[model samples]
Target chain A: MRARVLVELKPGMLDPEGATVKRALKNLGFSEVEDVHVGKVVELELDSEDEEAARERVKEMCGRLLANPVIHSYEIEIG
Target chain B: MRARVLVELKPGMLDPEGATVKRALKNLGFSEVEDVHVGKVVELELDSEDEEAARERVKEMCGRLLANPVIHSYEIEIG
Candidate 1:
């Protein structure tokens, strides 16, 4: 199975990198860019054939290391 | 409008960061992790109310700065 994990900052949190990108975009003429937030996506290939097992395992991985739960939220999609 | 841009390395690309993460996971007992690839998600808020325009603009942003087309491919989702 294959898993796609998306980890994003919690609402109301500040994102320095995103701010930088927003500034750069504005300077580059994309003035309509009002806000930006940067996040991570991890794609994993697992040995399990069962989608449920793979999703559960990847969620565990996210909780353990892939995401910082204090400041971020994550979602998992398995195929 | 809002846009979510997912940028991922093209197939056959060497992802040292992913390899490092994979090794760390293995060391931490996630032995079922066959492979890992890390990517980026950039969420943007735009002034336009039109979803199509928002997606187009974000795609242009990806083409110019958010992603390296030669090594990465990006998908834009506007809502």
Candidate 2:
């Protein structure tokens, strides 16, 4: 199974990287960019065949290793 | 408009971060992890209404600032 995980900083979290990117885009003339948030996308190939189990495992992975419980929230998609 | 950009290292590019994560997962008992690739997800809010034009503009942003054309490839989705 292939799992795609998106780990994003939770709302209200301070994201210096996102702010920097937003400013850079504006300077580059993408002035329409009103807001920007940077996140992590982790694509993993797992040695699993069951879709439901793979999804569950990926979620566990997110909680334990992929995302920080304090500041990051994650969404999982298994294919 | 909201635009989502996924910037991924091109296949065959060395990804030390990904390698480190894979190793960490294996150490954490996720031995079923065969491979992993880490990428960047940039979510943006733009002051645009046309979805088609927003998509094009976002792609241009990816080409110009969000992604490195030599080692990274990007996909853009506008909503």
Candidate 3:
């Protein structure tokens, strides 16, 4: 099975990197860009064939190591 | 309009960060994980309401700064 975990900063959290990029874009004349936030995608290949089991395992992975619960949240997509 | 840019390393190119994370996961006992790849998601909010123009602009952003064409490829999603 293949799974993807999308992780992003929790709402209300500051994203300095995103802000920097947004400023850069404006300076580069992409003034239409209003806001930007950077996140992460973790693509995983699992030995398990069951989608349910894969989703469960990936969720655990996200909670345990893939994300920082206090500031980050993640969504899992399985295939 | 909102746009998402997913940037990933090209196949056959090494990902040291992903390797390190994989090793960490193995050490943490996620042995069922067979492979892992790390990528980036850049979420952008643009003032433009036209989806076609948003996609074109985001593609240009990807080519210019969001991704490195030599080592990475990107997908743009617009809403």
Candidate 4:
């Protein structure tokens, strides 16, 4: 199975790297950009064949290592 | 309008960060995970209303700042 995990900062958190990009864009003349948020995508290939089991495992992975629960949230997809 | 840019390292290029994560996962006992690839998502809120125009602009942004043409490939999405 193939799995993907999308990890993002919680809604109200500030993103310094993303803000730096926004500032750089404005300086580069992309004046229409108002805000920016950055996130991570982790793509994984699993030896397991069951999609459900892979998803559950990926979720556990997120909780354990892929994300910091105080500031990050993640979504898991399996195929 | 809202725009999203997904930036990933082109296939065959090495990803040390991702490889490190994979090793960490193995150490943590996720034995079923075969491979891992890490990518980035940049989400932007733009003042423009036209989705097509925003997408085009975001593509330009990707070329200029969000991605490295040599080893990085990007996808732009607008809403």
Candidate 5:
């Protein structure tokens, strides 16, 4: 199975890194870019016989370590 | 226009952050996860009347700031 996880800071969370990128974009002449948010993309290739089990395991992985639950939300796409 | 940019460390580039995540996954009992590579996903919502112009602008953004071209590669999905 393959999974792609996108983990992003929750709305209103302070994101200095993202802000920095936004500034850089403005400097680079992308003046129309109003906002920028940085997130993580984790692609996983797993050996699993059961799809449901894999989904559960990957969700647990995100909750436990891949993302900070308090400030981040994640979306998982399984294949 | 909307764009989703996926920037990843180039193959052979050392990724300590990704390695850390991989270790954490192993600790969480995802022993089947052999390797992990962490990447960035930047979603941009831009007001652009021209699709080609937006694509060019975003590509420049990634090249100049969003990613370190020497060690990172980016893919852009435009809508």
Candidate 6:
């Protein structure tokens, strides 16, 4: 199974990196870009029996190491 | 219009940050994890007249600011 996980800073959390990028874009003349949220995308191939089990394991992986729930949230896509 | 951009380090480019994360995962007991490729995902809501123009402008944004083409590749999804 293949899984793609997108982990992002939670709402209301301060993202200095994202803010810096957004400011850079604005200075670069992309004024149309109102906001920018930067996140991490992790592509992984796992040996799992089925989708359900894969999702469960992946969730555990995220909770344990991939993401910090106190400040981040994640979404998973499996194939 | 909405666009989702995924920017990744080009193949053969050394990703020290990603390697560090992978090592951390392994130490955390995710032994099944063989490899991990970490990339950036940027979600933007743009006000464009059409998808084509949006893509063009977004490409310019990536080229000028969002990504460094010297070591990165990006894919865009528009809706």
lDDT of 6 by residue, A1-79 (tens): 7888999999999978778887888898887877778899997777665998888878988998889999999999988
Candidate with maximal DockQ: 2
Clash pairs for candidate 1: none
lDDT of 4 by residue, B1-79 (tens): 8887889999999999899989999999999989999999898999998888888899889889999999998878778
**lDDT, model 4:** 0.90
Runs of candidate 1 exceeding 4 Å displacement = none
- For each candidate, C-alpha RMSD in Å? 1.3, 0.8, 0.9, 1.3, 1.6, 1.7
Please report the TM-score between candidate 2 and the true structure: 0.97
Residue-level lDDT for B52 in candidate 3: 95
Clashing pairs in 6: none
- Kindly list the per-residue Cα lDDT of model 4 for residues A1-79, writing each as its tens digit: 8888888899889899889999999999999999988999898989997878888899889989999999998878788
| TM-score, candidate 1, first chain | 0.92
Residue-level lDDT of model 6, residues B1-79, one tens digit each, is: 7888999999999978778777887788766666678999997777676889899999998998888999999999988
Best by TM-score: 2
The sequence of per-residue lDDT tens digits that candidate 1 reaches over residues B1-79 is: 7888999999999999899999988988999999999999998989898787777888889988999989998888878
Q: Please give the lDDT score at residue A27 for candidate 4.
A: 96
Angstrom error at residue A57, model 3: 0.4
Report the alpha-carbon TM-score of model 5 versus the true structure. Answer: 0.90
Stretches of candidate 3 off by over 4 Å are none
The clash numbers for all candidates, in the given order, read 0, 0, 0, 0, 0, 0
iRMSD of all candidate structures: 0.9, 0.6, 0.8, 1.1, 1.3, 1.5
What docking grade does candidate 3 earn?
high
lDDT of each: 0.90, 0.93, 0.91, 0.90, 0.87, 0.85
Q: What is the Å distance of residue B10 in model 3 from its true position?
A: 0.6
CAPRI-style quality class for the chain A–B interface of candidate 2: high
- List the DockQ of the predictions in order: 0.87, 0.93, 0.88, 0.85, 0.74, 0.71
